[model samples]
Each structure stands twice: as C-alpha cells, then as structure tokens.
Target: MSKVDFDEYVKEYDELLNKNLSFFSKDDSYFCRYKADLIKQYSSKNPKRILEFGAGIGRNIPFIKNAYPESEIYAYDVSQKSLDYLEQKHPYAKVIREFKGFENFFDLVFCSVVYHHIPVDERQKATNDIFSSLISGGEFFVFEHNPLNPVTRKLVERCPYDEDAVLLSPGEMKNTAKAAGFNDFSVKYYLYFPPALKISFLEKFLRTLPLGGQYMLKAIKR
Candidate 1:
C-alpha cells in the first residue's frame, strides 16, 4: 500500500473518522475540535496569524477560525482536490495547494495527526521547513497517535488512509523538534479515557502516563 490519496476520501472523511476514533470525546467533531482546542489552550497569546499544517479537506478549519476569529487563518495541504473542497466550505481561510515556506510568517502553526503521513526520511525536512515558517517566538503544536498504545496501533494499522503512517514515539517527536531548533519543549500524553467515560476529569492528573491513546508535543521557537 502506498500513501493515502486524500482526494478520494474527502467527502467520507468525517463519517469514517467518527466511526473509528470517537473514543477521544464521543462527539461527532471530537477528533477535529479536540486538536483545535488543544492549540488554543497552549497558545500564550492571541496569535496574529495562524497556519494549519497539512490541513486536509479543512475539517479543522472552522474550529481554528473560531478560535482566532480576528487573526489571519491559512491552511496548507498537498491534495488539490481536498484544498478545493475545503476552500468551498471555508472561503475565510487562504488555502495553499502547493508548498512554500511561509518564512517567519505565522505566529502559530498547528498540526494534527499529520506527521505520520510524511515519509520517514522526509520528516526532518518537514520539521526544518516548519521552523523556517515560524517567527522567533512562534509556537508549534503537534498531535500524534501514540505508538505505545495497543488500541491506537490497531487503529492506525486498520485505517485505510493511514497506509503511509509511521507512528513516531514521544522521544522521536522531541528529537525531531530539537534538531529543527525548537526549544522550550513540553510533551504530554492524553486521551486516557475510552468513549463516553466519565473519568475525563482524571485525564489532567495522568499526563505523565504513556498508555494514552495519543500524545501532544508543544515546541516553541526561540
């Protein structure tokens, strides 16, 4: 199997996602909103410009837009069809179909479960590109599936669109950020509860646990 052709999955993406990964929040928009919310939570200030790296069909666009309604919002993706569809749905965002280093342009860059799709050999360049795209104090927020979790591993192995996914551990994620010149890094494991579990309150107390279904890494450019 090769990398996923996201264009083919654009229309059915939401249905497929919720059907499989609603364990995060048991909400129709959990996967998308969850990440967008995380970005907002960690942001030090209201960023003047925001970019969604690998935006794919713009499922996360609306939430990000709402979070930074006064800020400029931009989305980038390799799939032209997905970009086109996303643009139609979200004319507010400037959609980039091709890759160009924004070059110290974004105040914040957010990626949600995207790096696993990059070829293992190219992840270094991707990180470096992101470093170049952010300002001196810009922040990068990354969310990735936890390879250490059996259920997350099973989900990735079975996901059709995840054919190219190479799950990186928290340490690998940290090293990639460090090599890219990102400092003041903070890593936390989350999604510790299953679907509709009332123990959501306990998640904050368990950030150090590695058994969570997913993990988030926050890197700041200094």
Candidate 2:
C-alpha cells in the first residue's frame, strides 16, 4: 500500500491498537517508555537532525522531543490522515515527501513497528533506505515483534500487514541490522505479562528482566 493510505488506516487504527496491542502498549506502553528511555540514553550527545519513518499518530515524538528540543524532527508516512494528525500534534515537525533520500541527513532514525508491513522484496530496500539515510556512526533503533513468540507470530499474521511482513527472531534482527551497515547491534526482549493485566506495574517490573514477550533492537551505523 502507498504510504498515504497506510497512514490513513493507522489514524483510524491508533485507538484500536492502543486497546488491542496489549503486549506493546500497557500503561506507558512499550513504545512510549522505550522511546523516552532511548532519548535519555542517546540524545544527550545532541543529535541535531532526526527522522521517523512510519510515525503513526506521532506517539514517539513527544518523548523524543523532550531530550532534543532544539533538534529538527521530521516525520514521514504514506497516510495523509495520519500525517495530518502528526502535523496537528507536532506543529514544529516537518513532513518529508516520499523518497527524500535520507543519506547522512539524520544522526538518529526511529522506525518502529513498520518493517513488518513491507513486502519481502521491499524489505531490503527499506533497510537500505534506513542505512543510506543515517550518518556514519549514527544510530537506528527498532522495536519489532519477535517471531520466536508463538502468540506474537500468530497475532502478526492476523494484523493488517502485508504478506511479506514477518516477525524477526533475535538473531535475525541482529543480522539484518548488521547487513544494513549498523554495528554494535543489540536486541532485548520485552513485554512478558499476561494481556489480561493492562497495567504499568507489571510492565515496569518485567522490563527490568532480561527477557520479555516483545523485542527491541538497538543498532549503530558504523
């Protein structure tokens, strides 16, 4: 699907996902807190330029902005509705046109929950786009579904993602990041509580543990 249409679908879907995607969002939600922590850990060095691909409803922007208030934040998506919402939520943001060529323009590029939507043939191109856009020594942080989790794998198939969309095993995630020209790659699994309990206490407690239900990958461009 075109990015514009994809964005539109999510604008209508954000609420549904917020309620349904329990493993990813509980209390502060994995993405919210993860982005915040990422900002705290990495933004201190002050990356002046940032870009977010498939930034659905602009959820990560507020937290990311907290750390880099002065940095220019660029959001890109295919959905006009979602982009409209993003623009409304983040007036300071600049919406990037499609295929803007991210080469060496961003110190940090955030792509969350998007790879799975790409077709198989396009997955490498997407990775290449991310790689080409990052500056040498830049960082790309991805938080994706773990195929190792049987439940997650099944849920992904049911989701409105492209057929090529597949969950990534820890090793697969690391290897893909490396192939994308990112080094010092690390993958951490998260979200390991029963979905019945949608509270932050469990998430906070579970996050302290090394293994969880979901997975996050941190890769640095070298």
Best of the candidates, TM-score: 1
Q: Which stretches of candidate 2 lie above 4 Å from their native place? A: 1-11, 22-30, 42-44, 157-164, 194-211
In candidate 1, which residue ranges exceed 4 Å CA deviation?
A: 23-26
Candidate 1 RMSD computed on C-alpha atoms after optimal superposition onto the true structure = 1.5
Residue-level lDDT tens digits of model 1 in 1-222: 487888899888887887777656567676677677778877896899898889988888999988779999888988888899989999999987766847999899888889999888889998999999999999999999999999999988888888888999989988999999999988778887754777766877888888888899999999
- Pick the lDDT winner: 1
Report, for every candidate in turn, its global Cα lDDT versus the true structure. 0.86, 0.69
Instruction: Supply the global lDDT for candidate 1.
Output: 0.86
